[model samples]
Target: MSENRLREDLCFWAKSLFDRGLTGGASGNISVRTEDGGLLVTPTGVSMGRLDPARLSRFDAGGRLISGDPPTKEMPLHAAFYETRQSAGAVVHLHSTHSVALSILPDTDPDNAIPPLTAYAVMRVGKVALLPFYVPGDAAMAEAIRGLAGRRASVLLANHGPVVAAKDLEAAVFAMEELEETAKLALILRGTGARPLEAGQIAQVVRKFEVDWD
Candidate 1:
C-alpha cells in the first residue's frame, strides 16, 4: 500500500477503536511498518479519535524520526515487539477497560491472562500474557516484553491494558478486539468455573487455524 493510504488506514481503524470506547483520550498508540521498511505511528498525547494522516509520526528504518509530530513517550513498548517479532508489521496498544480490569484481578493468571474461553480468541489472539505493572512509559515494560522473546503476540499490562502485534494494521486491531472481548468474557465468568474449550477442541482450532500459539 502507498504511504498515504497506509496513513489513512491507520487513522480509520484508530478512530474506530476510539469511537467504540476501546481507547479513550491519548491512552493508546499504533504503528505500522511502512513498505519502505520504516514506520508510520500515531503522535504522542493524541487521541485516536482525531489522528491526522499527514501529521502522523514517521520513523526511518534506522529509527530516526523523519517527519510529522513526535512519537509517543511509550514508544519503547512498540519497539520491543517490532524488535523481537520479525514478522510484526504493526502493533497496537490500548488502555481498554475489560482487559485492564482482568489484569487487576488477583486470580488472573500471569502467564496466560485469559483462559481458553472460546475458539475465536484462541485463533485470533492466542495466549494473552499478563505482565507485572510498570510505571507508564517505563523502559522496564519493554524489557519485560523482551523476556517473552517474542513468543507472545498479545500481553496485558497489570493495571494497564493490552499490547498486540500482528502481520498488519488491520490484523493487529482485530486481534486487539478479540483480546478485549475475551477479557470481558473472562471477567463475566469469574468464579463460575466456566467450562472453556476442552483440550481437544483447543488443539483442533489451533491446528485448523494455524494459530500462533506460544
Candidate 2:
C-alpha cells in the first residue's frame, strides 16, 4: 500500500477500535511498519476515535522522527515488538475494560493470560503473556516484552490492557479483538466451573495454526 493508503487504513482501524469501546479517551496507540521500513504511529495524547492521518507520527528506519506529531510516550513498547519480532508489521496497544479487569484478577495465568474460551480465540491469540505492571510510559514493560524473544505476540499488561503484534495492522486489530472477547468470556465464566477446551483439543488447534505458543 502507498503511504497515503496506509495512513488512511491505520486511522480507520483506530476509529473502529475506539467506536467499539475497545479503547477510550486518549488511552490507546497503534503503529504500522511502512514499506520503507519505518513506522507510522498514532500521535501522543490523541484519541483513537479522532485521529488525523496526516498527523500520525512518522519515524525512519533508524528510529528518527521524520514528520508529523511526536509519537506516544509508550513508543518504547511499540519499538520493542518491531525489534524482537521479525514478522511483526504492526503493533496495537489498548486500554480495554474487560482485559484490564482480567489482568487485575488474582487467578489469571501469567503464562497464558486468557483462559481457553473458544476455538477462534485459541487459534488467533495463542498464549498471551500477562506481563508485570509499571507506571504509565515506563520502558520497563518494554524490556519484559523483549525478554519474550518474540515467542509470543500477545501480552496483557497487569492492571493495564492488551498489546498485540501481527503481520499487519488489520490482523493485529483482529487479534486484539479476539483477545478482548476472550477476556470478556473468561471474566463471565469465572467461578462457574466452565470447562475449557481439553488439553488435546488445544494441542490440535496449536498444531493446525502453528501458533507460536511457548
> What RMSD value applies to candidate 1?
0.9
Off by over 4 Å in 1: none
lDDT of 1 by residue, 1-214 (tens): 9999999999999999999999998889999999989999999999999999999999999999999999988889999999999999999999999999999999888988888999999988998899998999899999999999989999999999999999999999999999999999988988898899988999999999998775
Lowest-scoring 10 consecutive residues by lDDT in candidate 1? 205-214
> Which regions in candidate 2 have their CA more than 4 angstroms from the true location?
none
The lDDT, on a scale of 0 to 1, for candidate 2 is: 0.93
Where does candidate 2 clash, by residue pair?
none
lDDT of 2 at 109: 92
The models' CA-based lDDT, in order, is 0.93, 0.93
